[model samples]
Target: MKKRNKFFTKKNGFICAFLAPGILLFLVIYAYPLVNIFATSFCRWNYKNFQAPEFLGWGHLFDNYIKMFTLDANFKMALINTVKWVVLTMVIQIPFTLLVALVLAKKPRGWKFTRNMFIIPNIISTAAIGLIFLNIYNPSRGIITEICNKINPGSNVSVLADGNYAFWGVTFAFILFGGSSCLLLLTQIFSIDPGIYEAAKVDGASAWQIDRKIILPLMRPMIGTVSIMAANYGLLLYNEIALITGGGPDNATFSLSYYIYRTALGSTKLNFARGNTAGVIQFILGILLVGCINKAFRTDQGD
Candidate 1:
């Protein structure tokens, strides 16, 4: 028994010591908040009861969850919009970013400049980007209005005034800012051994063939990684939406994060329980999203 204890202590003691700080931090920062949020989600809490949370009992524990889906219109819309954002990001933003990365990998003239320019938007604050888009979409003094007026003298189309246009306006505000995603993919492409490309060329493999068969296959894992990041970004979208639309045109552009914020702090009636419930749902949805993406892009060793 002493030998076994000594062996484990010698083998794992240093490793555990090294990991202790991080584990403690995780418990204090992440795990505790997550567990507390879930627990508080089942209680009745609001501004009135902010100091003390009342448990809903086992029988009515799911009332908050039920109310979110069936009672709250904003929550329903936020859920739909959040799902749409995730789907659009995975389908459009990721593919577009990959295409740019592939092109940049070819080292075309001015490619470095182009890549830097693409990343500039990401480096700048999302608030700034949102404000820039807001100006561009401005009906009175914006270029979009100018273009519309030029096309048909005296035409007025307010992008943020209508629900559909507001949604698309918000979408366009951040959809193309996949600079970080492109950079990640480009790094993956560059990490591949140059010898592989040389060998493929010797075999008369065209650029298209090399990319389709070799580069792309090898890049699946990185693509999966970037997809997960982008999907999460989309799911938790809030800053840009908050700055640009403010869930405007009658809450047409509400995201899950914004909805939570509105419920908890943004409104007169602060519902901490409902807000935390939304957060719990967001957390669970994020996990499911990551799982689905991993499953979809999972690499098979047999290949």
Candidate 2:
């Protein structure tokens, strides 16, 4: 029994060693900010209130969230935009990405060159993309305007300048941006047993049938991760929306993360506690959502 216990202990120690860097990374990069934000959210803080952070006992958090739910105009618009963004990304972006992945998986014409070129937009920074889009959406003599007017005389469709279009424009801004890699997801999807596909083909399955019945079900875990990633990215959205709309023609596109920045730095800058509250709220929501999605994915995979 002692020998067995010693062996198990050594194995557990080795496992923990492998996990240490990631655990420490989470602590330093994510956990500390979370704890700090949560604590700060419960207090009445100011620019110079760093020394003695007053504890307001959840009042600020609740009031801020209540304001988000009821009073705040920007919050409401942000919420609406967030929902739309999530839906569009999940319904359109993920499927589109998968389609691209599928095309790349097939050794089509110029496959190697095309795959490298297709993800080029992701290599460019979001700020650069935002600026590029801004130019493309400019009303007069811009690339988009020039092209549109050629098609229909005097057509001036300034997408980012208008409220309705701005929502969609921001949502689709990062549609091409992958996380600095040929999507780990694409690799995962491609790695799926080709034998199943061959078997399905032997059974006279159409391409659409293969995708619908086999690809989608097997790709559920990756899809779920991508969905959550889209939502979380949309929730924490800034930059492109800021550069494109800057909370918009009428605060029509203020996301939670952007609102936090505005609240912390705008005319209502004195409400540091409330700003912190928003950050803490975003943090909590992100954790809950990502955890739930990953859990669901695991359960689906287990089955």
Candidate number of the best TM-score: 1
Q: Tens digit of lDDT per residue, candidate 2, span 1-303?
A: 998787778778899999999999999998997787778776767677745668766445465557557887876777677666656766677777777766666667886687777678877787999888777777764576677778988767777677888777776677656442336556766789999899989989988788879877887777776767776776688888878878887888888877878877775445676677778777777788777878876634334
Worst 10 residues of 2 by lDDT: 176-185
Residue-pair clashes per prediction, in order, are 0, 0
Candidate 2 backbone collisions, by pair: none
Error of 1 at 20 (Å): 5.6
- Judge candidate 2 at residue 191 and give its lDDT: 83
TM-score against truth, every candidate: 0.90, 0.79
129-154 per-residue lDDT for model 1 (tens digits): 89998999999877877887889887
Q: Predicted candidate 1: what Cα RMSD to the true structure?
A: 3.3
Where model 2 places Cα greater than 4 Å from the true spot, the runs are: 1-29, 47-53, 57-61, 176-182, 266-268, 295-303
RMSD of 2: 4.6
